[model samples]
Target: MSRPDILLYTANTMNGWKPLIFLHEAEIDYELVPVDLGRKEQKAPAYLKLNPNGRIPTIVDRGNGDFAVFESGAILWYLAEKYDRFLSHDPKERSETLQWLMLQMGGIGPMMGQAMFFQRIAKPNGDEVPYAINRYVAESRRLLEVLDTRLAGRDWLVGDAMSIADIATYPWARSYFWATVSVDGLPHLQRWFDRLDAMPRVQAALQLPEPRPSVFGEGDITAAAQENAARFKDQ
Candidate 1:
């Protein structure tokens, strides 16, 4: 079979990582094209045609005649179905797997990402900082706890194997590039996270150049981002 040319216009965010991790796990052949986020390149007119949402991780499936797939969770599932692996053979198990994926897409990802942004972006004055941080941190912790409970007796989310669900949720498991997760309290989640981390495919997918040290800008916004970066470090 002729391999599809996979054109991935993406940054190294969790959403982008999801698809690449899935591709590597499937051992599929494809091309990877980096979209320069540093230049606001995703907002260009050419990329707008591919994804009007102006997001990274937009994948073009060349084998499918250059059909495009947007949204990270959807793309992960598509890769699994296309590569014919890391998915359930039974219909019921497949449905459950998708359910978990949606939970991550709709719940964990959003809540955790908000926690990330608040921790690293929001200019909190007075009590806003602690309140916002506590709110989001508690919510994220609760969600992780739920996942831990659900994983009580299973090695994976669905069936007896890993699936697109794990790919969907792994990014948020360690947000902001291993920012502040303990991986200590949640034993089950830690185990699962380590299991995925140990995979050669996952490691290959994560094989990318570290972001170069650079200054963002020369003014106020730049200073704010730097401040957040500092506070993020303190956390």
Candidate 2:
């Protein structure tokens, strides 16, 4: 079979990492097109044609008539279905996997992203936004606790195997510091996080756009955040 030429347009954010995690795990051949969020490259006219939302982590399946997919979770689902891996063939297991994936999409990612914005970005702006900060932090923590409970007797989010559910959630949950929500007391979540972190594929995916770090340095982070704030102001 001829391998598809998949181009992933992404940055160094949680959502960006999710699809890469699945790609690496599935051993699918793909290319990385780094979108400079700090420079607002994602909002460019050409890029907007690929992802109308003007977001990173869009995938262009060039082998399939340049078919483009946007949104992190949706990208993972597409790849999983394409490769017949990560997601299960069993209907019950597949339903469970999708449910957990949605939890990350609707609850974990948004709440944690807001927490990071308020604590790391907005706080430094001197605006602080205490109400927003507290609300998201508390909510993120609550979500972490829920994950911990769900993971207590299980090794993976759904069934006995790792699936898109784990891939969808790990990136956000791993950055506990950024979200200002700790999983320290959630032993089960900690175990799950550590187990996934030890995987070589996960390590590789986390280091996308290598040799040039995706994470901002402390020295210029304030400026970086300010720039990002303007770019995502519509949110």
Candidate 3:
């Protein structure tokens, strides 16, 4: 195979999967360089030069003057614009697509991440703070309801076809179970999710760099979470 022009530095987390889905859907040639979050590889000086925030899902576009882009949402926007795929050029549709994409970046991603941090990570470490857990989980559920409302009677979040908005949000929304957020009464969101879940590209993207571990699976996730938490605490 030809050398990939895009180098994706990522983990198996929800945010990390956004670019993977987009790249797969767009059929772009990219290399996956898995960042070992547990090992604090993201915090190392070399990686920090690429992503000052020391986060996963940073992409170095070697084909584009060796440009590096951080933040998952930004990466999606950059790739979509560069490849001229999964994004609309029409004024209204493009704005709508970006609005929903921002919702994922500002709403679903943060709320769900906090929910997961508190529900799965904090609670297991004997730091079971009920207020934080309930606060984030409820907000995450409410965000899902917002998406459900947007998806009502519509197949995609924006325009008639799936765009970066859908790709960015799906990874987080699908992890509601891990975050302890429910989709109990959200039919539209559920339907949209099932549709994306059934897509060949989405399924293919989730497996790159290996499958992510389930919260319900066998492993010492608590210790893992604690290690990660300690890293962030020092940061």
Give the lowest summed-lDDT range of ten residues in model 3.
Answer: 212-221
| Model 1 ranges with Cα > 4 A deviation | 1-3, 123-129, 176-184, 209-235
Candidate 3 similarity to native, TM-score: 0.91
What is the C-alpha lDDT profile of model 2 across 65-158, one tens digit per residue? 8899999999989988877988999999999999999999999999999898876666665667889988998999999999999999999999
Which one wins by TM-score: 1 or 2? 2
Error of 2 at 158 (Å): 0.2
Worst 10 residues of 2 by lDDT: 210-219
lDDT tens string, model 1, 60-160? 98878899998998787777787787778799998999999999999888777777666555534222466776777777778888788877777887888
**lDDT (C-alpha, whole model) for all candidates:** 0.72, 0.84, 0.87
TM-score of each: 0.82, 0.89, 0.91
Report the Cα lDDT for residue 49, model 3.
97
Residue range 1-235, candidate 3, lDDT tens digits: 5688899999888988889999888888888899988679999999999999999989999888889999999999999999999899999999999999999999999999998887666766567899998899999999999999999989999999999999999999988877878899999999998899799988888876777556323356666556556645532
Show the colliding residue pairs in model 2: none
Better-scoring candidate (lDDT), 1 or 3: 3
What RMSD does each model have against the real structure?
5.9, 3.2, 2.7
